[model samples]
Target: MNRPTVVRTRDELRNVLAPARRAGRTIGLVPTMGALHDGHLSLLRAARQRCDVVVMSLFVNPMQFGPQEDFASYPRDEERDVALAGQVGVDVVYAPDAAHVYPPDFATFVEVGGGLTDVLCGDPGRRGPSHFRGVTTVVAKLFNAVEPDVAFFGQKDAQQAIVIQRMVRDLEFNIEIVVLPTVREPDGLAMSSRNAYLSPDDRVRARALNQALTKVLEVAKAGETSTERALAEARAVLAEAGIEPEYLEARDAENLTPVTRFGPRPVLVAVAARVGRARLIDNVVVDATPANEPMAASVDTTGGAPCVGRC
Candidate 1:
């Protein structure tokens, strides 16, 4: 197996990717917090298919984790991550240290203001805007360092993907943001690095997140457009599995605003729950229209089908 050349600093990344830039070859970036899984590799495969040079960043960004969050316990295995990237034909693995990513007196941050940072995972009582601030900042730094033509993200992080897309547009990053489908285990649980923390029982309970989202899709397809009504069905699914979600909400997928009813624009039904030591999240984008009107986007009703994956 061919191993990707791993670089540990911004200068090394720039020096490495400069040739591709000079040669006018398109470079695609897959920014990750290491702990490569099928969900992450799916993005890598897409990048390999679309770009001449595929750069995957393996930095486990400290800034994104809240004080009580599992930054310390979050998984990291550079050797295995590099092997996985190599398997997908990833050209470069930029795995920088925390000090390098956030140097001393590092005061700058990138934030997407307005309501996008005010709801769901961004709620002030939860991870809040600080989480996304950390995310956008690191992403901006990566954009500057790699200067790739495109960036890949998974739809499982529905809000993060949306927020990053906004940041890209507002900041004029000159990179294409491609949101791919969420990958899941055969049991319907969305694949996440945090899944590593799940105990066996927690692993089974974690399936509720996807099951809940699937319930929302079912209700919407049945002409139940009321966000409250659909979410009620979703909550029941969580309740059945004895999994109380931190937040289960339906919002306008495009702007992340509260949606009273699913309309022409897609509605994002998302859930975040704590299962044992793992904080798992899952979402399905609902494109249900009234029975009288045609559906807005093609959707898959299969139990574990991802929201954006089918849409």
Candidate 2:
């Protein structure tokens, strides 16, 4: 296995990637906070297939987390992350420190415009607005620093993917954004770093997110086009599971605007809920045309059918 060369500073990162760019080789970047998991590796594998160099960034941006959120206890294992990155053929691990990323003099932040972040990113008003702002800012900075030919994001973060895609188009970034399917656990729980916080009971209840989303797919497949009915049924599925759903609504897959009725364009059925201490989000894009069957629901890039290995 080719071990990845880890760099913690922006200067070191540029020094490392400079030659690859000068050599006229394509670069692929997978931006992530540390604590590597199967979902994170899937992104790297996709990047590996397309680019000569695959760079995995492991920085836990303080800005993305709320004051009461898990920034301090959000799980950090740098040594293990590097080992896992190597196993997946990652060429570079760009792990920058908080101070290094945001110097004492740093003041500017990137805010995605056009009210794109009004809904998701942990319920705007309840938490500070900085979550999405921080995500966009850090992404902008990473784009500037790494200068990747292509960048990858998971479909699990459906809204974030949409937000970033808009930012790229609005700001005119040259990098291509690719959103892959969401990877899930054997029992159908969407894989997430925060899954570590779920208690055994919560872990079991957390499967409801995927279960509810699955029902939406089943509803669409059954030719149930009532957006109101499908969404209500999904919420009832969660209610039956005894999970507290935050938001389960139908929206245009691309813009995330509320959709009263399904049509030719794809409808993104997204849901966020709190099963335990962990707040989980999962979504599936269903073709509302009634003729076309439901497409790939979540990001399942295991390179096989769901439950083939994990189950």
Clashing residue pairs in all predictions, respectively, total: 0, 3
- Assess candidate 1 and give its lDDT: 0.82
* 10 residues in a row with least lDDT, candidate 2: 302-311
Candidate 2, residue 5: Cα displacement in angstroms equals 0.5
Candidate 2 positional error at 119, Å: 1.0
Q: Encode model 2's per-residue lDDT on 1-311: one tens digit a residue.
A: 78899998989999999998999999998998877678888888889999999998988888787777778998889999899989989999998889998999998987875655776553565453567788889999999999999998888887788888999998999999988788878888888888888999899889888888888888777788888998888888899889877778888888777787767789888888877888778888887555664564333436211110110
Q: What TM value does model 1 have?
A: 0.93
All models: lDDT? Answer: 0.82, 0.80
Best by lDDT: 1
lDDT of 1 by residue, 74-140 (tens): 7878899899999999999998988988879999989898799878998998887888888889889
Cα RMSD for candidate 2? 3.8
